[model samples]
Target: MDSSSLLKEYPLNPVVWDEMCVQNEVRAPYHKVYEFLKQISTEDLTRKEEMARRLFMNQGITFTVYSSGEGIEKIFPFDVIPRIITAAEWDFIERGIKQRLKALNLFLKDIYHNQFILKDGVVPIEMIYSCPHFLREMHQLNVPHDIYVHIAGIDIIRDADGEFYVLEDNLRTPSGVSYMLENREITKRIFPDLLPQNNVRTVMQYPQLLYKNNPNGLLGVAGLMSAYRKGNVAIVNAPGNGVADDKAVYIHVPAMIKYYLNEEPILKNVPTYQLNNPDEQAYVFENMARMVIKKTNESGGYGMLIGSAATEKEMEDFKVAITANPREFIAQPIISLSSAPCYLNGKLQPRRIDLRPFALCGPDGIEIVPGGLTRVALREGSLVVNSSQGGGSKDTWILSK
Candidate 1:
């Protein structure tokens, strides 16, 4: 039999864009590797897939999966077929990312110093003071270059329309970069020639880039912020940046972009409802089952209510929490996050995914690594892709074409 005839059948979800193919045919950026895949026998393909897993195992490339109230180190699930973005798409994404960072860093600096965005009424003072991480101590404290956010891991996602959106920004110390770099190294081994054939961009310089831009050594956000305040040290994603990452503050991002950069936002956020707004809160509470509510300051996927899955007790508890301090929360319709093909149970299946591209700011300026970590919800149909919440990662390829 010919190599094409030996290919294993993989089900495709037509509702979402498949990065590998436009329809049944392989997408242009993936042509080189899809053709290569057609030539591999199923047995040999399985062996190669298994080898990829073994390589991860041997290299100790693992992430802690904390589920069911316990932590377990598991080999981060990696798919051999990478998620590819065209050069045009990447250029647009890069511009949007840089625009966002510039505005956000300026916003942070403004809130801590002049409070201009607040005084001008671009963002409410309550929203600034309402943020749990908003440090009063940061007032009038100056940092090198007036740049507050040295590193940002902005969460990005594509919907059915095939447009990119910034889901959220991780400014207070972004994670998963190690997984991103490792994913590229593994992809190199899986399809050594496919990369050069596709003219894929490299992500190996992220660590060095971060090192060159951020503090040489630091512990926690507050400590680093304190050091920078005293002119004794420098920090990345400088502390008190939580003011921007706060889900409540997230709603004001577009306004912030317009206010600070005076530029329209190239990327947008999912429609969010601030519980602090009486009308929005009423709608959110009444339609609790249709929305996802999150605490403004919480991270690591905690303090969240998946309205569709919440039990009566959980709903009541969340309602009480919202009632006690409404400003601490925000709600959004549960987005049917786009799905991508993932290898699972010895077969290719669809899984919801999200991307987090890291942006670095220095005297040189904002630089985003062309590649990022493609986090996949390993469990069938699950939307939460955080490693702490049973998510795995994949390699992302930004094609030169």
Candidate 2:
């Protein structure tokens, strides 16, 4: 379909010509990108797929996928349509995310030391006692920089009305920031014109931004000191964070925050009841078919039981497991994740997806990179967006023009 016909079917508002005229008055760095995309035909985008493939090959960017055999290396998929972020929008998001992270770090610290929030009833003491993520081992271990969360991924999504909402926070081992940098590079090379005509800022320097506060800053440091410095940083998954990120560990975060931070958490966790709570555990045992039970330490969509999908026998097994060791499990209502348009099989289709925007906390403050990784659940109606599954990704554009 032509752009006009597609717009008619989709029922989107027309671009305001007056705004375009005003935007044109400024000598935007992305003017070349805007002009280029306007002239290219859809056929050009198809041809550019080859350019994207070659770019991935040249850059040696690849991910390992485990299948029947295991350990298969493949290039990360790339899409040509770059997600744009306007400066104004980015500024707002940056501020909100920074505030959220700062609060969360303080909460984590408090959870390990004191029980202030819990005592204040901001978070119930029972709730933390039940969380699997609450690590007694980490109770007094001081983080080197006094920063529990050096990196975080805050997910946000725009509803049909186009207002953004926080979906979830991945405080530990958040991946896919690498893809954001690679995707922009590929989009710029493949369809240089698709960039917004206004003064669209590039997230190209994001890695640098993430690495900027390394004890050495930008001046290349050498050898052991760089290695030994407590703040010496790299983007590899958070060190020793998996313990707390585990679903079981999550049960403890509220307690940890209360114990360590002494302040109430601004955001609320989804209503989750641990199997260890006698009344809640009894309730879950009775209504095993209406909730979602998850193993505390498993990830990548594994060890998850959707009560509705379970047979009587499976439900029985889950009940027995929970009854035997309530601390090993937690249950919550199954969340209906949102969806977005994604390119699949040469056509645009609605797919379940989630966002994971990276946040870096440094000496100055927290900085959330604009345009996070948009992960799509490739299966028709699936909600699991893990790359380990048959999921794919798209470029998230926070448009400046």
List the global CA lDDT of all models: 0.82, 0.61
| lDDT digits (tens) for residues 43-147 of candidate 1 | 676777898999999999887755566778888777776777889999999999999999998898888888888898889998788678898878888878888
Which candidate's lDDT is highest? Answer: 1
Candidate 2 similarity to native, TM-score = 0.72
The RMSD (Cα, Å) of candidate 1 is 2.6
| Residue pairs in collision within model 1 | 150-237
Worst 10 residues of 1 by lDDT: 1-10
Question: How much is the lDDT of residue 106 in candidate 2?
Answer: 66
**Candidate 2 whole-model C-alpha lDDT, 0 to 1:** 0.61
